[model samples]
Target: MNYSHTTLTGDEGPQQQVTMFLTRHTKTTANAIDLIQGWSDFPLTQEGIEIARQFGRGLQGTRFAAAYCGTLTRHYETARIALDNSGNDNVEIRFEPGLREYNFGSFEGRDVSTTHQAVAEWLGYSTVEEARAARGPKFDLDVQDALYALDAENMLHTDLVPQDRAESADMVKQRMWQAMTNIGDLVSREGGGNVLVISSGTAIRQFLWTIDSEVDLTYLGNTAVTKVDYDKGTFSIEQPVGSMAYYERGAQ
Candidate 1:
């Protein structure tokens, strides 16, 4: 849970496996400030922008052979800031929808701080924040639990992720696995190197789950880095979920 200013060394084995550096985006207005954000594009807050810059600085001299991100602005901006600051500023950032977050459905722009009791009444939660909280610390660690939670509220969206249904945790895992597998293959074919990925928390959680299903996918900090090793078409977690010096400059 304590993420220091560190990088995962990809020298763990022979040339068969590729090491990928996957990181959640720094705080968005929803994450660090206000408004519920799920698949919604919100620019990074002022503090978030600075944190991302620091995120880049934390890497210092580290190099990413290639970089990728989701189509959302938050994902791209975060990657731009961090990748550019990594001292290897020339890495072209690629956009891929496979790294996008779970669609929040009807809950996209709701105010998390107040006025959602009516909406939560049938959603199995007493407030909007309660439903939102279902993501991280409050997640039951069971895919069924996530399904139940999403089902309670996502019905309001006529065209939700699964057609009037909220996206299941297993669905997230599937998409993330495919995305990572594709990237891992590219890395292996091109020899091997660190591939930077800037994505959202929910997608990243599923990626981590693929590495270690027993791990509780929670507490992933803003800009936290999770490293995975892809070897001979197999993937393993190198670093599950860890942080850096985003809060305090000298901490990491």
Candidate 2:
């Protein structure tokens, strides 16, 4: 993909576009075991490291003006590996806490299946499968909503610390937007170019939802790239959301 955008500058000086290559972190041990990673820290699995390298190899010629990732092991490692393989290791990656995954609070590190079942019950569904059938693409968002509600009501895992309650969807959306806009504005001021960002699956999905509610929220595979363009104080999602084309290219 060319990964560039052009828009009229109008009275705001020269037109500058910052293309963001927003990617999800590679697979982690938690992911392999069907655990809810949330804010819980976990290192990337061997497969994940190779996937990140492949992602980098796919972008052999692309030069990044700026690089960033959440202040988490998985996020940082994926970004580091990708940049190194892509020949952009010289770029310093800035850590952004706002880019962190949605804090699952008490639910962090729990089994994914159990978590979904609890969320389903909270949502009035008899089972997770029933919820999935009814909610379709919105199932994931509903799960987040359930988590927020449960946390707010002090209903999740009584043994877990109260402070560990899940973050509301709105909160995640706000922080993500702030972080992304900050990065975009900063890059635009510095004469616009390609920007690389590594964030978690749920965080990326929620952020994209804030930009375009109709976006497919089904799934975001590890190391998948979602391209976005920031131009004229607005953000737009480019075609081929959650793309694996780059990874496929590199794997070949």
Candidate 3:
């Protein structure tokens, strides 16, 4: 596909635009079991592998100038499978720790219901359902804030778990923004072209939230692609967040 765009500047004539394909990693064992993965590393499920293959097949004709992924097994595994199936195996996948998911500290590997229950209490909601209804699109981000508060207070601390280990919403947003900006800068320096980036669900959402908080944050399915355009120094979402068209196309 022709992912490049050109814009006329007052005196600069035309400028090249770089396209960023930000994708969420496929389902993992933790996800399959309804666990809060956080910074934990989990292998992709068999179904996840197949879906990633479909994501690649859907973009069979597209070429990327660069590829990047978080320094997690799930992240790299998804990127590898998609690139291999898409015939872009030749592109080197760069690992960036800044792209990793939010650290949930003691909450890691816990049941989602359990975590949400605690978060609801921390946020002063009578129940998780109440919290969800009250916060609506911001509920997910509120969960992050509640987790950070719980961690900071040592509410769930054990000998192995330490206080203040979880990342606050601000921290996640800062790091994700920096990581994405750096990638954009690097690709733009290389003459601006299409780029592929694989990251976790929450991390990807946090990054997009930084760009536009009004974006829908209800859910982001596995292997869903969120297209963004980079030109000069600005980033803009190309479509609604978390479009599963690629996966659906590949399924056909």
Question: Which prediction has the highest lDDT against the true structure?
Answer: 2
62-169 per-residue lDDT for model 1 (tens digits): 788888888788888888888777786898877777788776555566664532444344446766567557644434234333443655655444455545344666
Preferred candidate (TM-score higher): 1 or 3:
3
How well does candidate 2 match the true structure in TM-score terms?
0.91
Tell me the tens digit of each residue's lDDT in model 3 across 30-79. Answer: 98999998788988999988989999998788998888888888888898
Better of 1 and 2 by TM-score: 2
Error of 3 at 13 (Å): 16
lDDT of each: 0.68, 0.86, 0.83
Give one digit per residue, the lDDT tens place, for model 2 in 1-252: 122222223334454799999999998999999999888999889999899999999988899998988888998899889999999999988888889999998778889998898899988899999998998867887788789888777775466565667888888999999889878877787789999999999899999989999998869999889999999779999978899887888876
The stretch of ten residues in a row with the least summed lDDT in candidate 1 is 1-10
lDDT for position 146 in model 1: 42
Q: What stretches of model 2 exceed 4 Å from their correct place?
A: 1-15, 157-163
Checking candidate 1 for backbone clashes, the offending pairs are: 3-243, 5-252, 17-231
lDDT-based ranking, best first? 2, 3, 1
- Please list all clashing residue pairs in model 2, or write none if there are none: 105-164
